[model samples]
Target: MAVSLKRTPLYQEHLSLGARMVPFAGWEMPLQYTGIIEEHHAVRREAGLFDISHMARIFVTGPAAFDLLQRTVTRDLSRVEIGQSAYALACNEEGGILDDLYVYHSGPEEYVVIGNAANRDRDFGWLAAQKRAGEPVEVIDRSDELGMVAFQGPKAPALLQSIVETDILSIPRHGCGYVDILGYRCFIGRTGYTGEDGFEVLVPVEGAVALWRRILNLDVRPCGLGARDTLRLEAALMLYGNDIDLTTNPYEAGLGWVVNLDKGPFIGRDVLAAIKARGASRRLVCFEMFERGDIARPGYPIYHDGREVGRVTSGGPSPTLGKNIGMGYVPVDLAVVGTRLDIKIRDRFGPAQVVRRPFYRSPSLGG
Candidate 1:
C-alpha cells in the first residue's frame, strides 16, 4: 500500500481559503488560489503570503560545526555573519552538485540550513555522514518542529510592520531578526524567491495556522506554488530541479557570483577553477516571444538558422511583464542579448529574442 503524505499545520487553513492543493515532494501543498496569474500579480503589486512549511529546516550546531560545514558546502561559511544568510551548494567529491540550499548563521557556532523538500532525505544523510567522520558537527533535523511562511511584494514591509513590534523598515536586505508573533517566537528573514521585497518567517509548526490566518486577516492574499514558480522565474532565479541540477554548475546557471573563487579551497573549488579556465560551453539566457497569444514552455526546442541549438528550461506567461518570457541554455556564442531565435510552441515555430536576465525589476523596499 502507498503511504499517506504529511500535511503542514496550515493545511486546513489553506483548504478554508479555497486553495487548490497538489502533491509536492511527498507533501500536500497548495498549487494556487484564485488562479496562478492572479496570485502571481498579487505578490508583484501588493503582497502575497505563502505556506512554505514543506521546506526542510535542519540545524547544525556544536564546537566543530563551522569546520565541518566548511568542508561540505561550496560557499565560504566563514564569511556569513550572524543574523545573515547566504546561498550555498552541497557537492560530492567529484564536484557534482548534491543540493543547493540557503544557510543562515543564527549565532557564533549555530547555523540553520534550509534544503529543498525533494532533497531533504539525501541532504540529511550526507550531513550525517560528515558528522560521523569526526567532524565536530551535530546535525538535527528540525524540519518537523519548524514551519515557514513567505510574505512577498511591494507592500510586504507595510503588512509585516503592523504585526511585529520592531520597525521592519530598518532591516537591510538579507538581514534577519527575532520577533514574537502571537505568543510564538519567530525568526524573520528579509529574503524571498520572488524578485520582490519580502520576509520569510520561521515559526513553530503549531503556530503556523494562527500566523497564516493573521496574515490573511490583514488582507494579504494567499499565494500558492504556481505563482511562486512564475515569480521566481520572472526574477531569473534558478529552480533547482528544473533550471539547474547536478549536471549544471553555478557558472553555467548564471550564479557564479555566489561562488568566491578567491576564497580558499572548497568542495568544488578545484573543479570550478578548472571550469573557469576552460570557459562554459553553454550559457543560460532569457528570451521573450515576439507576438501575443504565444506560450512557450520547458523542453521546447529552440532553433537558429532552421537548426536546433538548444531547449527551454523554464518558460511561461509572466504575470508581472504581461508577456511570455523564458530561460534556456544555448551555445555560448548565441547567448548574447538581442540574438534572434525561434521557439517551437505546439509544433509551430514562433519568433523570439534573447534578453537580459531578471525579466522584472522590483521596486526598492527601503524607505
Candidate 2:
C-alpha cells in the first residue's frame, strides 16, 4: 500500500500558483512554479518566498529544557540567551551527525529545535528518549500544529517588515522574537540557508495560508525547493542526507566549528575530541565545473590522481553564478582550492576545480 504524503497548510496556495508539486521528505511540495532559474534569480536579485512547513518544529520546555539541550546538542547552549538562536548539531555516541538543527532560546527555560524535515521522527524520538528519569523536561513535537515559511533574499527584510508589527531589522541575525503576521503572533527568526538576509516565520497552522498569501501579495516570488537547492548550493550550504549523515562526522563535513569539546559532556563529546586530535581523513569541498555542458549531480564519481576517490554529495547548476557547482568528499590533501578534480559524467570525465565555499555573496556584504 502507498502511504499518503503530507501537505502543508499552504498546499492550496501552491497549487493555485500553478506550481509543479513533487514528493520530498514524505511531503508533497512545490518543485517549481515559473522555472528554477527564474525563481533562483528572483531570490538573488530580489526576494523569494518558500513554504518550509514540512520541517519539524520540536519544543523542549519546563525546568530541564536548558539542561536537556546542553546534554544533547554539540554547541554550548549556555551562551545562547533568550531571543537568540544558534545553529547546532545532534550527534550519536559515535560522534556521527544525527541532524543539523537550529536551537532557539524562545523563553525562560524553553527552547525550540528546528530540524530537517526528513529527520522529523528520528530527531523527536532521540530527543524524547534523552529525558532523564524524574526530569521535568518535555520534548514535544509541534510540527503538525505549526507551519513555517522562509522569506529569503536581499530584499526579504524590508518586504517582511511591511507585514509584521515588530521591527524586523532590530531582530539580530540568528535571533528570534514573537511578531504579528496577518493578525497572529508568530515566531520570526532572521536565519536562512540561502546565505542571504532573510526571515523565517513560525506561525500557527491556521494562519499559514493567510500569511503566505499576504507575502505573495507583496510581489514576493513563490519559489519551490528546486530554487531553494540551487540557492543553497551557491552558498555551499550542506544538505542533511547528502553532505552529512550517520557515516559522516562534523569535522570532515566542514562543520567542525559547530562542535565544542570544551563545553563539557555531551552525547559524542569524548569521541569527537579524539577525532579532533587525530584529524579527519577526508573533507567535504565545493567545486565548480571548468567546462560547459557538463554538470555534476549527487552520487557522481569523483577522481583525483587518476583514481576514483569519492562521489559527489550535492551538485547542480548555480543560476546566480551561471556555473555548475557541486560538493563532494575527497582526501584532505586534495580539498584545497585550485585543486583539479574529475567528475565522472556518464562515460567521460569532466574537469572541475575546487573553489571557495559560497559562490555568491551580496554586494551589501562587501566581499
Best by lDDT: 2
- Residue-by-residue lDDT tens digits, candidate 2, 6-25: 99999999899999999999
lDDT of each: 0.86, 0.92
Candidate 1 residues 1-367, lDDT tens each? 7968889888988898888999999999999988999999899889999999988788899888787787778888888888888888887766567888888887778888888998999899888788756666799999989889999998988888898886777877888767898889998888889888989999998888888889888988999999999999988887878788888877777777777777777677889888878888889899999977777899999999899999899999888788999989899999999999899998699999999887888874432
The candidate that achieves the highest TM-score relative to the unseen native structure: 2
- What is the TM-score of each predicted model, taking all chains together? 0.95, 0.98
- Indicate the worst ten consecutive residues by lDDT in candidate 1: 358-367
Off by over 4 Å in 1: 1-3, 365-367
Q: Which regions of candidate 2 deviate over 4 angstroms?
A: 364-367
- TM-score (C-alpha) between model 1 and the true structure: 0.95
Q: What C-alpha lDDT, on a 0 to 100 scale, does residue 99 get in candidate 1?
A: 83
Number of clashing pairs per prediction, in order? 0, 0
